[model samples]
Target: MCGVDQLRVGLVGGGPWARNVHGPGLAAHPATEITAVWTRRPEVAGELAAEFGGRACDRLDDLLDDVDVVAFAVPPQVQGPLAVRAAAAGRHLICEKPLAGSVEDARAVVTAVQRAGVHSSMVLTLRHSPAVREWLAGLPSAPAGPDTVASARWLSGALLGGPYSASSWRIEHGALLDLSPHVIDLLEAAVGPVASVGWAHHDEPDLWRYGLVHEGGARSTVTMSMRLPIDPTETEFAVFGPGTPHRLAGRTADASTCYAALLDELVAAVAGTGPTPALGVERGLRLQELIEQVRATAG
Candidate 1:
């Protein structure tokens, strides 16, 4: 039985990410308990709930009714409307990136959360990694100006053959929707808010290259793809300024570790013991807007 102080979490997916990260993270966190689980596939949900010592819910509403918060590990399109419903029901939210498939849907989610006065947090996983925190901490704090510029590249063979390759939404949308949120969010945090998409390009096999102009005149270039022939994904972020360049390379931490950190902060915010997380639904909406701009520019 969960303690009175533990936040009851309803997990809303049955896929690998949910099974591997969300279930394990919530069950392990002292401040949270996986009280209910729901997914399109009831059998899979049952399996997950059984593994985590939670009950599988046959309907979304049943899950919502049984828990204080909703943790989503589903695709962005599936997540948006459901998130709005969860917010309307007065449950706090832990949302996935991109928020929704389109800017309109993402905005709807933001509006719903605002209207309901519910606390929400985005699953910007990299932002929670200790190495990423240290990297951002070492960068210049002042708003970046013309003298500062940054670059990022995330190349992976994920779509070539893997569990994620089976994800229809990821295959359709490619790296821009699946990966740019993490990169853009990190760059924006390291420098300043992105003011405009200077240019954008996409090619066959999921390659994306884009330029962004940040507020205060700083600029950034990004290159991403999920069909590359690389073994381990190649990721690097660097800022070149007045002094020596600062760089963050390779993986920071496993997904579960970062997610646990996210849960720690989110549970605190929901309990009124901590400030609202900076990476919330509003931030997700902003990132979605930027992604749309990139797509439009590419066309």
Candidate 2:
């Protein structure tokens, strides 16, 4: 457990997301502090630690010793083993989407966290946005039926020419791995659990389109691409039902703001003052399973 007033955080990864959102958000949040930093690149870790008020640790073990929890912004493959080690060390976890590169790895992390009895949360940033939360809250609480349907599209040029463009994992995996988790998660949260991927397709230039059947008989279709030429990225989510359609258009709050909200939940969980995070590691594992199903269907 963390200190009653503040949670000491060990941040893994010094990439753009880590530098811009995780590190800054933790430093700015009243209930948390970036107590230690570790990354594959020592200099990058040192830079982040210098800017975020944490010590640059040469090893992950050293960082774990200094912090009450671990927040990961690393790639999924790298994050998996490190998260397992951190959970084994009895620290709480704040993990990135998909939990890990593979479903098996994600499940391992889940098992480790459960064995340690540590709290865990996934970075489903949109769910933490006030606007997105309001939109979700307005939707009908009852399980969706066949008449309920949703459509979402997230088209971006993230892998074309941006800070994320250089990401090897994003390039290799495309938007299905990078963006589908958020879309699928939101759809399920708004409607019902995804029972299966009805159909899926992946075209050149990273376009992905898929249909899903929700367990409650509702359905959702998703279109995504990170290599599009579109400027300002187009994103929208709309659900249609018997009464009226609800929509959450464009981006929600900035990553920093959403991350702050996530921090609030994590802090509360760590202090035993709140329920376990709704978007936790087990949730990540489930998303991974759904994503894998989509991939298989696409092929």
Candidate 3:
């Protein structure tokens, strides 16, 4: 229900994910105008800004002068205070996934957004396929409960060969915190609040797995990594729903598909114009907290 003319937003972070997905998707939306981008790389931001007709601001402070929203595309470590900075300026948020590497930071983000009475959504919903969305939509309108799943896989391999440079933060940060949150949020969305299993541990240097109990009393296993062979259906979806089996194939890493859809949803949510996919800030924070726990266990 968003009108053609609504909010004027800005984006921070000049990374590939922001350039390829968040920045571009915001540009193409009816409700958002990426009016400024805060990135250190002035040249690149300038080019993208020119193409999108938004301004290029060197400092984050410059963005506050004109925008109604701030989309933080930086890494988890940098997102905490920046989120508060934006909220303090009275801007809504659309930060990227893995909001922060720890639960505390995520909670800080949640508090800032809540206190401001402003909407905030993370980008981990990036990998949610339309089939995944549709499947989740069909869940019976029963009271929230913990989900009991026999098994599940959180798969991705795009960073296998390394992205852009040989030094991949995706690998350095391990799997759980960086990549698995996408699936965690997806599962949490399907079920409900995912609670911790005490101080967890990371299973491998490259892999992160955790024990989670959803509100529905379902045991959930969250897995993630930067290592795997690329497959067309790598981001595929499958689920056992209350006694029936359903699988969705062909979830390619089409950057624009699901990422774009979620952007539209966020836009609508900000504009108070349409139904949102019921995103919970705690879900992301829990994933971050689990990541911290697993990492500490490995050390």
Candidate 4:
């Protein structure tokens, strides 16, 4: 890797997300190449390989043998075990989030990455959105003088009917597990760590809410759903404290743009000059722990 000019990447999973975002993003990056692709369906892998300028491989090991890193767009359950195998084979990782469906599975991914001493990143794309970044940076150190109350409301019709309608995991888990992590991670970043879940609730028809007590005494509320039927309002994060409220607008770019930035981070991390920060596997595990806490409290 010392004198390598391009990082060869093995892309796993050929779902809509892989085809739309991961494939396009990796293909667009100049510092890396999608050198191989392997999926549960060989035809799908072959299609993506042809479209993205990579070779299709019949086996994971064959793909592994041809690349320096592996980027996964598989479901949470599949992503977990495969990630472990990839890390064990000494491949760097670009994993999608809610790293695994269960805490135990998520922990295994963390251990594998650590033992392999590989650079890894989780696709927490919101952290790379320019609009989101501007808002985060504009906030003061104590963000509204130590008495901040933040709230995020993300309403969507993804489960009701959209590109994600076919996602079985999202259908089974619903909004809490699938969508809450995105909102929670952003809220936690803007405020502080979620020290405790004061209250959490999910009613029928896709309404979910949480009262999160952040460290340093700041409090935050999160509400999200994939069943909202109306034309959704802009996803907003608002904070109110000693002064006028401050709000951060959601991303303006498409998903591919967001993922491209994430890929850039992965490239830099592999190059040994970038810090993975909140996008790393450990942060992903912590998010999984938070998800379990919210679930336990909601139940």
Candidate 5:
């Protein structure tokens, strides 16, 4: 955007999501210049800092003072307070999705950004994908009958728990907030607003699973457990677009080079040119609300 000049970034999560998505994505942006990174673990922070040749700050506040934007990649539970502080400090926020663990906290984060008169964003980078872009551009009028969605299911398996910690506060009662939101967002994009829904959750000490029913006869079933034997990774949204069963592929796939194109769109957003997506913090919060509704009934 704006001819892609250097824009400073302060990353606030150095773990897998950060390392895999945020760090690489920002580094590759034509207009972005990462200045610092923050993580609770000094070893991880310092290691990335050295690799990137940037400073490693222990506290998020300190990093705030050092960069133009903050990419929040921390766990879902730790995001609210950090977002509150970052927004108050007047830095643009690039938050990871599932915006917050719950709708209430997501609202609070949005409120903070508004109160501070700052620009903030939640990174659902998938929305910027090429397939998603073209597909969304020509999305047919909403279908008028029963719809079935096959989506990503990851939980209680090596996918979510083996390497990742169960210590995170992603779910208290259900996996709807953490796992289902992605699917719901995709479904909403393909279909219309979900007017009402029903759900069932299979909760374990470290796992949560569910089946969802949406208005307009759309239904989806998913499982998010920390005790899986395999890592379930597949995200695809299919709907009869223009009567041809249009599909833009799924989230578990990156063959479309979505992240790279997404960064370009972000640049476009900053430039005030082309549509990079107008989704703001508020939209994410709204989605979180829908997620909570489905999650609350997990039993």
Candidate 6:
């Protein structure tokens, strides 16, 4: 439980995404405050703390003692153990996707959170994306009508050269492992739970494709890559089955807005007044299973 006015959040990880997205996003959220920051790098933590009106904490345990909630921006491997520690402390969690480096680690997080009864929210951007939300709301509940099949592509040049190029995990894991959590989560939301993986492949270095069978008999294809040397990028999520096709079009709100919405949902879930559907550590475990299956198939 948090204070009536706002939640005091202790931020972890001072990476590029944390600096650019998470730092500003928490600052901009009216109901949350970054009360403390802890990063592996002391100087980077200090910089973020100064920029976000938080205290720089050298020890994660000290930061945990000071906050009502913990928000993680680190890689999955780092996120797991720290999240378990936070859960044991009865602190709520806002975590990055993929939950952990391995399925076993991810399951540990889920178990800890469930045992502690703390609210947990995974940072699945599309779960909070306005455009995606609109598209999802417009979808058929049962995937029974025409044009119900869906497909998505998240091709990006993140590894070619950009701020994210420095991300070692993203570079090593490739697109399917790095980016497919959001894609799979979104597709499952639009259709139903993924009944099984129809097929998956590492198309080439950095490129991957997957076929998914939804619980409702609807099917989807997802393709992604971070190695493509493209000027801009290519991304789309559209559905087509029996009727007219529906493509995710129109101007989408920026990531900050989506992050803010995620915080809002986290607040609601913590308050026990909102739906917790597919946005927690449990969902992260499910995504990890999907990733493992893909990896095994790829290998």
lDDT by residue (tens digit), candidate 3, 126-178: 44556666776775442234444523465556555545324345556656656
Residue pairs of candidate 4 with colliding backbone atoms: none
Q: Which of candidates 3 and 5 is the stronger one according to TM-score? A: 3
lDDT tens per residue, model 5, 1-299: 11247667888877777777778777776687779888988889998777664689977778888877788888776887788888888777777777776678888999997898666666665566665767766765543346444333454443345444453555353344555655566666666566655665554554554554556565555555544454454344566523566665434336226556655655566556755345667777877887676656753
Indicate the residue-level lDDT of 173 in model 5: 34
Measured against the true structure, the TM-scores of the candidates, in listed sequence, are 0.98, 0.98, 0.83, 0.95, 0.80, 0.94
Candidate 2's C-alpha lDDT?
0.92
Residue pairs in clash, model 6? 146-242, 146-243, 147-240, 147-241, 147-242, 147-243, 148-241
* Winner by lDDT between candidate 6 and candidate 1: 1
Q: Tell me how candidate 5 scores on lDDT.
A: 0.65
Ten-residue stretch with the least lDDT total in model 2: 1-10
Per-residue lDDT of 21 in model 1? 86
RMSD of each: 1.1, 1.1, 3.5, 1.9, 3.8, 1.9
TM-score, predicted candidate 3 vs. hidden true structure? 0.83
Scored by lDDT, model 4 comes in at 0.84
Candidate 2 global TM-score: 0.98
Off by over 4 Å in 5: 1-4, 143-156, 160-162, 165-167, 170-175, 203-227, 231-236, 240-242, 247-252, 274-277
**Model 2 clashing residue pairs (backbone):** none
Q: After superposition, how far is residue 235 of candidate 5 from its true place, in Å?
A: 4.2
Computed on alpha carbons, the lDDT of every model, listed in order, comes to 0.92, 0.92, 0.66, 0.84, 0.65, 0.84
Per-residue C-alpha lDDT of model 4 across residues 1-299, encoded as one tens digit per residue = 41356889899999888989889888888887898999989999999999997899999999989989999998899989999999999999988888986899999999999999998888887888877777778775543334789999888777887678799898888888777778888888788888889998988777888898887789998888887884553577888776667887654446777887887787777777877544788888989899889889999
Badly placed stretches (over 4 Å) of model 6 are 1-4, 143-147, 249-253, 272-278
**Cα lDDT for residue 210, candidate 5:** 53
lDDT of 2 at 46: 92
lDDT of 6 by residue, 1-299 (tens): 34566789999998887988889988888788889999998999899999997899989999999998899999888999999999999999999988998999999999999899888888888778888888888877754433368898887788988888888888788787778897888788877888888888886668898888887788899888989886567778888876567788433547888898988888777667787635889999999998788778667
